[model samples]
Target: PHYYSLLAAYLECQKVGAPPEVSARLAAMTQELEARQRTALGGLGAATEPELDQFMEAYHEMLVKFREELTRPLQEAMEFMRRVSRSSARSPSRADRCAISFPLA
Candidate 1:
């Protein structure tokens, strides 16, 4: 799930014309994270219940860290894109102008 989100963010970076190195670095990090997850899951066989609980707790911590690390670059890229868009003279597309319609309570 996080891997897919990273890929989507990388694609968005490309769509917004972020630097080549930025996208490349993000792709590399995503691959590394996925590899780590695969390795961790593969090592879980034959563990006792208490050990499994500890492993899960540690895995959860790792996921939180991974999410924080992955989001920072994407957030920076998005903010940069927003700044550029705001400064440009070109009008936004119709899709950009459209607002979400919420159902009344």
Candidate 2:
């Protein structure tokens, strides 16, 4: 949701086509988002836990799924743009190497 919101706001700003004032507002919004993320992640030392190792092992699969589904497409598009004035495309789509591992002692 956050990614999509950011993309929409970005594309909207782009479609407005960079009048100087609009560009300044977009830059401000970008900074605002950075500040929000930083504030959200500011607490760590006093956090509580219930077997973090086990929770993390469970969520590792979730992280991989989210990264593949959400982040991978954006990464691919960025790579393609970096090639030949956006004339090139992604090399190939590879199957994800999904794995299963038993959590243990």
Using TM-score as the measure, the top candidate is 1
Question: Quick one: how many clashes does candidate 1 have?
Answer: 0
| Per-model CA lDDT versus the true structure | 0.63, 0.55
**How high is each candidate's TM-score?**
0.39, 0.30
Top lDDT hit: 1
| Candidate 1 C-alpha lDDT tens digits along 25-103 | 7667767777776776677654457765666666656655665676688789989999888866487666778867899
- Looking at candidate 1, the ten consecutive residues that score lowest on lDDT are 1-10
Off by over 4 Å in 2: 1-16, 44-105
Query: Over the stretch 1-105, how does candidate 2's per-residue lDDT look in tens digits?
Result: 144234434444352435678767777777777776666567563354657645665555455455456555666777776874544334332343344568897
Model 2, residue 59: distance off in Å is 21
